[model samples]
Target: MARKPAAAYPFSSSPGSSSARPPQPNTNLNALRIPVTPERRPGAPSPSSATTTSAASSASRNPFLTPSPGTASASPSPAQAGRSTATNRPYGTASAANSSTHLMPPSAASSTASLVSSSGSSLRPQPTSGNTPRAALSAPPLNTSSKSATTAPPSISDKFSLSPDPSLWGGNLSLSDREADDYLHNPDPKRDRKNDRGGTMFTARGIVNLGCLFIMAAGLIALFAGYPIISFFTTTHQSTQGGYNLGGINQTGQVPEITGALGLIDVQTPAASKSHTGWMDQSTYDLVFSDEFNVEGRSFYPGDDPYWEAVNLHYWETNNLEWYDPSAITTTGGNLKIWLNKTENHDLNYMGGMMSTWNKFCFTGGYIEVSVSLPGDPTVWGLWPAIWTMGNLGRAGYGASLDGMWPYTYESCDVGTLANQTQNGGPPDALTTGDPDWNGALSFLPGQRLSACTCAGEDHPGPQDSSGNFVGRAAPEIDILEAQVYQSTRTGAVSQSVQMAPFNAYWQYTNTSNADFQIYNAEITEANGYLGGVYQQAASSVSITNQNCYSGHQSGETGCFAVYGFEYEPGDSGYITWINNGQPAWTVYAPALGPDANTGIAQRPIPTEPMYILANLGISENFGAIDYAELVFPVYLLIDYVRVYQKQGSTNIGCDPADHPTAQYIQNHIDAYSNWNLTTFDDFAAVSGSTWPKNKLIDTC
Candidate 1:
């Protein structure tokens, strides 16, 4: 049901026209132009006032368009049925109805006043508001429908008075800007509360802050122009053992800190023992064991937090632990800082920053046993995880204890020799000075060695001159453990020592003396004296000292620094001040000492044929850390410098430092003995060639 528009609002003349009557355009501007209207002439654009034809069609159903009930004037007596007055009107507005009689019959005013619209002719004007009558008349055939004077009412006194919408002409009655604004912004009264919209502001601030941060960072870079940038990798170069080598197992970027996390070459750490991600880069991983110390010396690993996964080597990535700046160990200037953390991330095999050199780098021939500190708490396992190496490592086939003994036992150590000794050898008291073993033991000459500065009872064997002055010096039975190969010292030298006695012990107990040993992929041998695992069986020197060379009941005594480093000045050896965390205790030693072949100590004692570097942590089952390992390739060992120098030569064929095939290959032949994966005789035998049972001693079989 459509309603006809109200009586056509006579297009009120413009307000400005009040005083200055202007010419009118032929058509009406009653409504916006409907260009789509059919009446639009062919090719001629329609007027802006064009209206819809449907408006006329809808006039029939709507009473309002029916001329308002009885609005017909001068009833045509039913004669003017087909004759009608019609015109377009804007939607919803009334059409201006007036007496056509006035236009044509000026004198018929009275009759027209009382007369209604000609029955079906057109709308009639009455005294709806004003008290005046309009003359009756018929509209001229100018197509009143089309525009003419075009169709504004004969006269409209006031434009605003003609319609309610003054805004249609840009007047105050229209929706003023302020009114529109108020309507849109009125907002709910309830909305009057504290509004903290940190939306766009936050985003903009974030962008600004981000910009500031970048600027600050750039400034910092400029501040430290010469310093290396802390970037991950541009992948600009390849990973070599040198020149950005990244050391295979180490992080490729700046390491802001390292604390609870393992070092680059993480040794037998809880991390390595569990997860198996970096099993391919074991050697470099072992270095991380450098921080295996736990709670004042107890070992810490996944055992403490079974949920520890690979520790992100990047300091910034350390979300678990706190970052600390200590007085030591920094890649930058000033104080060294160590950022450490412990978190839970899937905790898969539970590994990281831990590794080994089962058959990597270069280490073969005579056994090596590492002795490091053990945790004070046995219940807390992983206290003495070791980081010993070996190469060439081929032992007596299966029964030989070490299948890769020759190359396998190259760098080996008894697991926790101090407490786990019976399995590796007899006790310290039962330790036979010299013995040949295949699995992994070292043989040292009888008696210890002491310097001229100390007494005879210190590892010294015979008298000096004729003064009965001194016999031999004291012998270092075994103390703390060894470190993971050589570390990067301050000065970057590579000189270190391994106690040959324990390796001898390892070999003796295993009963396979002929196993080969290698170092840095070269046959294990002295620079000139001992050639490739061969030492003169002939007797050597015997020196002992009261310090670091005592024996028997006194040997298992309080504390001592068994191994001291010296300058690589061809012949000058030095010692470290003995101090237990800071306790005063003179090192125990014997009178004099002797060497089978190896010699460099002040006493020129016997050369340790096949030395073993025991994991210091494993040695005590308590100290739980590598006893002070001093690798003083230090041209001046006295300065505590010197790093293990890797020549970075071209290898014809072997482990690829780039892809790290060595560690992978070793993992294929090795397995850590743990609860989840206990080492079996078969597993150990697979690699224990000739002397299988002898070398692989964790025999649950």
Candidate 2:
């Protein structure tokens, strides 16, 4: 913006220029420099004196030399008629200031480098009291461009008027970024100039502009105030395009701004075969899950929820995976046995585990993979410990199969009977229509399931062999069958992996993954085709969708589903996952299977479909311990290393069939909370049963 036919304001010499002639080029840089720091000694060659020599050398060296004797005559150097001007310059060294050495003003730089008019005319010298003007001009132009061209050191005291070079302060005083922004991006500078002042210091016009800005700001603010849904997209676009680092979780919700829409969920795993300990809940983690499971009799002891458990646990797991750990169960370094006394242990070993709101925790839809590392042990045998999710669902006989719909009933369902339905081929094909234990005898055999726990009359749900009678609290098996999310680890839920086994054991090696360590992952159903932008999806959208009518493209269909599928990346995201031998992980989708759920162009499910998540960890025999568990859907605990990413511009579009799309999950519920176990990043620490201690859910700030 330095407008100039004036050759870009080539050089503006002040009235105090000392050189009578212009210097030629070819001068060494060292010739022109002043002492750089405080160490420069006094009586050193003065920059003014050096300038005199360099100018002579400059004039003698180059053919392009030009001089302005006339201009130099009009303006003598300030030192010639010493005048003090600076108001706040700091004091300088006494010797440097008072010695025979001609001193450069502490405030102003040496005035010897002033450029001559370039006309090559000799300047009319000022009438010196003793010396003749001709005598001053006689020294062969003083080699105008001398080899030692010098400029005086800047004044460090409050003596001389100040003048600084452009380089001294390049980026310090910016035209207020906002004002500059208005000037740059906005074409109208009048209102902007007015508002610019208003933003800093108010004026009449600034106030008016301020009022207008407030109105506009209010309108912009109203655009997505409570409407987390639309706010996610717009704000995300703004943050990314404007250059901001966004959080993976915060992108879905607001950070530093607490909203029911952004909270964690509480999930409890079934007790280990030998020890009964449930999954971690969200309340402890200072977060809330969307969908929650109802427990008959469970105890909550203060902060024993999600928050405290979120502490980095490298030491806990490092010392816990015992040398002879049974394949079934996971052991940790932070031994729970010593930390929690008898009273605490009693509280830790609960009868039933509770679930949080599913809608609140996980993404409504997309592939969420949980990375897990299974202990290579054959002795673990017969352990089925699963990491699955559950939600409320109802089926209406054959009506749900072809018509692509299921009715929501307010009635509680039979846990076993509910399990019988909600499977491929509607019972007869993949599941049993009646009691396979009574009717088919061995027909109910667990296929490759080491932890089936079938002991003749044991197939029935109600009575325990030791307890006798068939009567027991009947809860619908709705979870097992209706559960659409799952993936298995390399081991089983047989009594061996998750519980203690009483016998000499050997760690078995198996590249083969069993059904016991399975997990179920499913995403949420939203109002339209899907939630989230093509590249950067937002959780806020789903949260504010119904409440604020803020949704993405193609709104209007109503099944609210979220993403809870299993992670299947290799090496980096993890070597092993919930299912497969860390390969080909199985993800269950109702009405969508095989090619349909495969994530190809043809497999995308449309419309809003209500969905939930579930996993099954079955233990047939007692396990010595569970090495570790995987959570398909993400939670703060299940991550190897979480990275918050924000993209600029509008690269985000819609769902991608090539890869599973992460849809926004309503963060308002508890059951939707999935685990993002950070243990995934932990350097596998070798531990023994003696050092391994389980974590007792401790809820604390």
Candidate 3:
């Protein structure tokens, strides 16, 4: 069915005019209708005058309405059809609507009911205030026509152009009457209590935030407290072989037996022993040699043991007053005992025992430790007991064949002689002139003796033949423990030292003035601007003392036992360390010893030759004359055990004869120098044997 168009509003201006407006199709007629008998103010214009007044004059009188800019038209525009006459004010404003009703044509009065009946109550303007007249604002009769029933009501803007005064309405431009009613009826309790104490802190979100903070704090406490708590309950055993208590008491009062985590907290393996000195890992060392002396009544004679042999010679080097007798050394009750006693044998009034592994065993780099109880007779005078080592090329008893290598730590050339001088002032030959090669060059060897070299300018005399000519090279020596009683004052004093011949080139090039090169407990000669100067007799010593350990000379007392240890490594970064009962007493780095100045080669020159161990108890005349009347007789030096350890898959023993030149070759060289035909020492040249073994030397092994 076709729908009819909405009726035009009464006050709409005509088309094609300045005041023309769109039709108000759905505008409420009640809001625009003129009253039958409108009331007027006193002295107001008559109704005829008001009806004939121009829109401009009327707009001037009423602030709520304004006229079009130009002339009024005869008909309304399509857009002005249903629009309210109240253009500047709200539709339901009682005052504005009442004042504007006089502008409506008298003809609009009769048409008001028909327009309202057609538009229906849906298009009527609602009263904004309770004071507004209900009769004036009442809806018309309901429209039963299908067109009016289906049609939507005009928008509130078209029916009632209501705009409240900003000053009176508090600038609430968007709030309608219905919205204000809703605000008044339903209030927000939370907003009303916003300024109250603890309002935000006690909120649901605050509770959740506080809960998160508490959880984080708890986590931090657990993070810090977990370790010690776990450690308290755990048994911190280095090994896992023993039963442990697990916070449970047993009826038998024994520790509970359990396995795995509940029983123990093993921090390290059984083999991984802790290093007392903190320099090296103790677990990496393997026992390469040990003598516990468990066999009772065991003799320490020449043929008694395979690993050790007693020295039966007098120690003439130190001018000792004791003869080292084999009988003075014995294994009694699981201990090797060296007895010091008065004796008339060997033109000496005293006798003691010395044992060594000279030819039988040797090691290049290792840890050597000895558990020993020194002779502690307070009355004993001139008593000196020592545990020491020497290069394998030297024999302990000053054997004629190998005695020449003493005090030479490293292999070196004889520097005192001319580099190119020949043997016997004759042409170079295998018999007359020996090999002069050194460091891959033909040069003067600075330390090695007898190798076609003269001992004229050398600081120390080398081994001599029956004719008093230089014969052999110098060997190195390391003193592990030298317990001496000097003038009856140093009763329990002990010292460790390293002895070597002054390798001139080493001192010549290095900054000998540096603290690293300073010599301790040794004599120094500062002649010729030599800083710490060359050691007068190449020996440096450091005293070792431990107050907790027994160092008194109390014979047969187990309380006198101490563990003396020495660790040696050979190379540029190598070092020799002295340890007293697991604590480092002293250390010497190889590089601090200096290098060869001539060739700038062999910078460290640490002893690389394998060395054999020796321990002796001697009564020396060097300290003082022994007071036999006050000296205690039959005092003993007890040795519990001697142990040598090396790293895994490594050995310090260099006693294999196959690794060196044949003994015959060395003998032939010595024999070549037997017939000294040269009249002057200047005829000799410092030369080394070309065939001399560069590695291990031929030893007694």
Q: What is the C-alpha RMSD of each candidate to the true structure, in Å?
A: 23.5, 29.7, 27.4
Candidate 1 whole-model C-alpha lDDT, 0 to 1: 0.24
Stretches > 4 Å off in candidate 2: 1-357, 374-378, 382-384, 391-433, 438-582, 586-701
Top candidate on TM-score is 3
Model-by-model lDDT, in order? 0.24, 0.22, 0.49
lDDT of candidate 1 over 190-280, digit per residue (tens): 4544343423545777889989999999988866862445432432432233211123332222222322333333332444332211111
Residues 207-251, candidate 3: write the lDDT tens digits.
Answer: 999999999999888778976787777956433111111222221
Give a tens-digit lDDT track for model 2, residues 621-662. 122233234321111111111111111221221211112112
lDDT of 3 at 476: 69
How far out, in Å, is residue 502 in model 1? 12
What global local distance difference test value does model 2 have? 0.22
Q: Is candidate 1 or candidate 2 better by lDDT?
A: 1
Question: What lDDT does candidate 3 reach at residue 460?
Answer: 29
